[model samples]
Target: MIASTPRVTATHPSLPAVFLLGICALLNLYSPQPILPALAHWGGVTVGSAGLTISATTLGVALTAPLAGSLSDRLGRKRLIVWAITLMVACTLCCVLSTSFHQLLLWRFLQGLTIPFVFAVTLAYISEESSAGSRALVNSVYVAGTAFGGFLGRFVAGTTLEVVANWRYTFVALAVVELVVLCGTLFLLKKEANFTPSRSLLAGISGAWRHLGDMRLLLSFGVGFLLLFQQVGSFTYASIALLHAPYNLPPPAVGAVFLVFLLPVITTPLAGRINAARGPLFTYLLFSTAGAAGLAITLFGNVWCVLVGMALSCISIFAGQSASTGFISSHCQHDRSSAIGLYLSGYYLGGAAGAIVPARLYAHFGWPGCVVLLVALAAVSCVFACIAWRK
Candidate 1:
């Protein structure tokens, strides 16, 4: 007879640790964004080239997510998380020392490579530990922590870059912040009592690969990709746009725009409640429509309208993301880590694409063009959400 994997109920302490891990992972993943303009000036590169900093890290995560997820299944989530953070700290220091754009890209890529282990495992770990009744709530809380981290990473890095006038110093400061988060992650994280190691590494990898055939999972992946593409792409170009005409905001002001991310801090858990009451399909379609509306509103070009649109976008994006992730977790009873990894592989791949594509659209076609592109992506994301609902 086959043996069942052990399951341990999560306690109160586990919640904070998971939240810290969410913060640490997302902070590391997005630290370079608000500073992309500074990177361009520092390296004498174009805006598109500077955008590569965002792409490089996400591409790294996209490439390694499947492998990282499988390994976490084979070893343990906590073990992989420790290694990921250790490598992240090392890579951030390397980024601090980089003398040229190419070197910075290289280090960013390396950092991307390591960071996914933490991201891919954390949601899966939550899935394993929590009961179904509370899963959406806890997952929403974790997502909220990620939203906060995203806001803090951009706010802190952008403000510091404004003062320091050196991108290197900004990264140095971020690395210090990461180090502090690292200590907390190590100390606060508990052992994995719910997960059982795979019989072999190959078995783990095979299991992850097999899930690619799942249509619902595929739709979820598409939703993730489109949502992030809209989220990251809009933010990337919007910052540059704000720095130029119409708004003419300085770098510091542009960074402050990320404070709109505070909207997600509320929206994520609210989304969980909505999802629990109405179901993932209802939650997905509702927030996706909101996201589409938010993007469409940004075409108005008024500063207040833009801020309102951005805030709406933040709320809708996090709500949609939480709903989709919860759907995937509830569906994938086995190899859930691998499924989430694939979902994030799509998510960050969209981010990687967003890092570059929107810049070109902005350069060639202007803000209206970027808006059109994002709105289309959001529309498509809604279609996928509907498909998931039907399937």
Candidate 2:
């Protein structure tokens, strides 16, 4: 008789650890965004080129996600996560030492490479450790942490730049924050008691391949891609737009704009409840449409209107993200880490594209052009959610 993989009754996991996982994973991902315009000036490059700092990190995330998944499946979850965060601290400090723009980009990419180890592995950990009754709630909390972390990163980076008149100090501050999180992770994160490792590396690879063949998973992946594309693309260029035009905001004020991200910290947990009652498909479509409307409001040429729109956009995307990730965790029957990894690969690939494509559009056709493209992407996400998540 063939032996089956061991299963343990799910336990109530540490919600705080999961939250910290999200924060540490994302703390550095978009730190450069609020100061992209200043970076361009400092580097003697165009806005689009400076945007590469964001893109390079996301590209590394996209490329490394699947491998991180496979390794987590073979080795274990917390082991990879702890090691990855340690490496991330080193990379953040390396960014401080960078003498040129290219070197900064290289370190950013390396930093990106370590992130999936924390966030992706943590997702699999949640799926395995949490009971069905509380799974979505825990996941929502993690998303909320990410939203806050994203805001904190940009706020600190931009504020430090303004106060010190030096951008490099921002990296030092990020490294310190990362170190604190790393220590918290060591204390709070428990070893996986419910995990059943894949039999071998070959088995993990074959499992990932099988996941790609599922139409439901594919559609979900597509939705993830479009969602980040809209969020990252809009915010990236919006900072630049605010720097120009009638608004003429300084870098510190632009960072303050990310306070809108705090909206998601409140809305995402609420979204988890709505998703549980109404279903992920309904939740995804509802929020995606709202996001597109929010994008439209940005074109009104008023600073207050733009912030309102961006705030709505931020809330909608996190709600949508909560729904999508919850659906994947609930639906995937096996190889949960591999599935989440594939989903993240598409998700951050969208983020990478968002950082680059919107900048080019903004240069050639202005903010309105970027808005139109993002709105269309939102519409596309709604379509995929309808098809994939239909009950």
Candidate 3:
């Protein structure tokens, strides 16, 4: 029989550790967004090229998450997380020194490479330890942490870039934050005693792959992809898209649209409750459709329409997440870290795809076309939902 992974029954002390981890993550993740415009100006690149910063990070996560996740399984979450943070700190500092777009990209990619391990370890920490009743709540807190990280990332970037003059300082601030967070983590987290390093990295990879061979697991992954695809696709570009129109808003004002993302703060917990009560499959069907519909409205190209679309999208995400996470927590009684990793791999991959493709649509076809693209993705998500839930 395959060895059963050790579970985290509960951790009274890990709470602050979770918070510190999220804050440090926010530092690395958001630096590019605020500095993108400056980077573009310095390098003479377009807005879409600036968006590549986000995409590069996602790409790095996609390429490295599996390896990182696997190594984490063998090496232990504390080691992987510490190593990942150290790398992120280094990459973030490098961002401040980058002279050109390519240099920034290189640093961002390295930064991206470390992110998945951080997220994978965090999710593993939550899943391993939290009680079944509180698991969803813990997951929501973790997601909230990511959202807060995103919020702060954008917040720091949007508020300071113009005043700071040197966009490099944006990353410098980020690096400092992560460095402080890093220092605290050393004392806060207790390393897992049960960590059994995999015989080889390949062992963790092969093990996860074999487990994911199930169709249900595959469907769960699809749900994660769609959830993040639409969310990231829409919001990552939200600031830029709004600034173009009648609103012609400033960068900071545009960043306020991230408030839509904050809606998840409320929805995530509610979704978890629904997930606990209703089961994962049913919740996904209900909420995923809501998100699709919201995106449909945003395509209409009016300010009010876009705002409404944004809210619906947030609601849809929570619903879909509820179901998707329910299925993950319930089904993968063992090797749940791998399950979370697979889900995240698909999720971040979709995030990466959204970062690149939707912007291209906006650049060429305009706002209406962007909506069309989002709608089509939503439609595809709907089909996946139907198939996955059918079981």
Candidate 4:
């Protein structure tokens, strides 16, 4: 009988700890989403301007992800992950004290810069620690935590916004929740048994750039960018659309829409199982179709259709991401961590663009216009996925 790898056995504690890390990272990053309309009201900004809260944070993430990935290689993934959560907890608390939108944006951008410490490392950690047999499932578990975090952050903020009278207090409450998650992570985060810190920053950057030359990996990065752009842009603009005009959803009601995220908690693991059975290429194509179909359905104005569409899209995002991550991890060798980091840079850059550009589209073109933009991006992602498949 063959023995299980030391890496897999050692990764046991890392699994749930990184799960908590995913939750914490997402909670800090997405807290502004449900409250954009409130920001517009309290900060005397337009909806498009208010959406910058999310854009600024994601832009920071885009800027820092590659650096964080390299540092994770040099500093150890666990160290960076722990430090990021500690600093992010403090930054999130400080966000509540901001007196103006500009101040708030500054804090959010700083908050974003810290996110790569956790996110960039967590993927590398999972890739390094888990056995190939278990990597997809573990990745899916982390993705599930992220899905729940995005939901909880929006839901809690929206629900709290209903009762708190002050928007800042909603963040205060989220900060406290994250603080608990932080302490839990500190207790549970395991040491990296496999990683070797890079010798220097120059070598690390050069190594990461080398992976960018691979066409298959490059297309994967493009797919990551477009998928996230569609996800973030559609959701960010949808918040504003649902809050105004025909729906006029109250803050809590707007938050309730994120309940769609719950579907991924189920679909993500299922996706891993399917990917195991069918191969990631098939899994990617299947879910990409599902996501595009979901976006298309949203073109309908009915609340039921929109809700169902959002649910389908949520399932697609998590499952598709799991497949993509698994595929990337499987494909890379010496440059695995750097490659993931580059993918994340594209992913969050798309997110930053998604947050801002979709809001502008919605402002000019309305909700249908927003759906059109998402559909077009999803189609582009499909094209990229096709190219990746051919290679």
TM values, all candidates: 0.90, 0.90, 0.85, 0.89
TM-score: model 4 vs. ground truth = 0.89
lDDT of 4 at 27: 80
Candidate 2 global lDDT: 0.85
lDDT of each: 0.81, 0.85, 0.71, 0.79
User: Compared with the true structure, what per-residue lDDT tens digits does model 3 show for residues 131-169?
Assistant: 677666666656655656766676666666767888777
Please provide, for model 2 over 99-203, each residue's C-alpha lDDT reduced to its tens digit, 9 standing for 90 to 100. Answer: 888998999999999999987888888877776667777888888888989888887888888788888889898988888888877887777777888999778
- Which regions in candidate 3 have their CA more than 4 angstroms from the true location? 1-11, 23-27, 193-199, 236-241, 244-251, 296-302, 318-326, 358-369, 386-391
lDDT of 1: 0.81
lDDT of 3: 0.71
- Model 2, runs deviating above 4 Å: 1-13, 34-48, 244-251, 358-365
Per-residue lDDT of candidate 1, residues 1-391 (tens digit): 2125443333556677777777776786777776777788889999768977877887798999888888888888887888888888899889988889999999999988987788879888888777666778778888888898887777778778778877787778877777776777788766676787788889889989889998888989998988888888888788778888788988767777888888887888889888878888898888878877877787787877788888888888889888888888889877778888899899987876776788777878998899898888888888888888664
TM-score winner between candidates 2 and 3: 2
Best by lDDT: 2
Which of the predicted structures, 1 or 2, would earn the higher lDDT when compared with the native?
A: 2
TM-score of 2: 0.90
| Least well predicted 10-residue stretch by lDDT in candidate 1 | 1-10
lDDT of 4 by residue, 1-391 (tens): 2223387532477577766777776886777666778899988999779978877888788888888877777777777787888888788888888989899999999998998787768888888878777788888888887888878787778777878867898888888878877787778766767676678877778879898889888989988888787788777677778888777888667767878888897788788888877877788879878887887787777777778888888798888788787778878766567788899899877776776777677778898888887878777877777777563
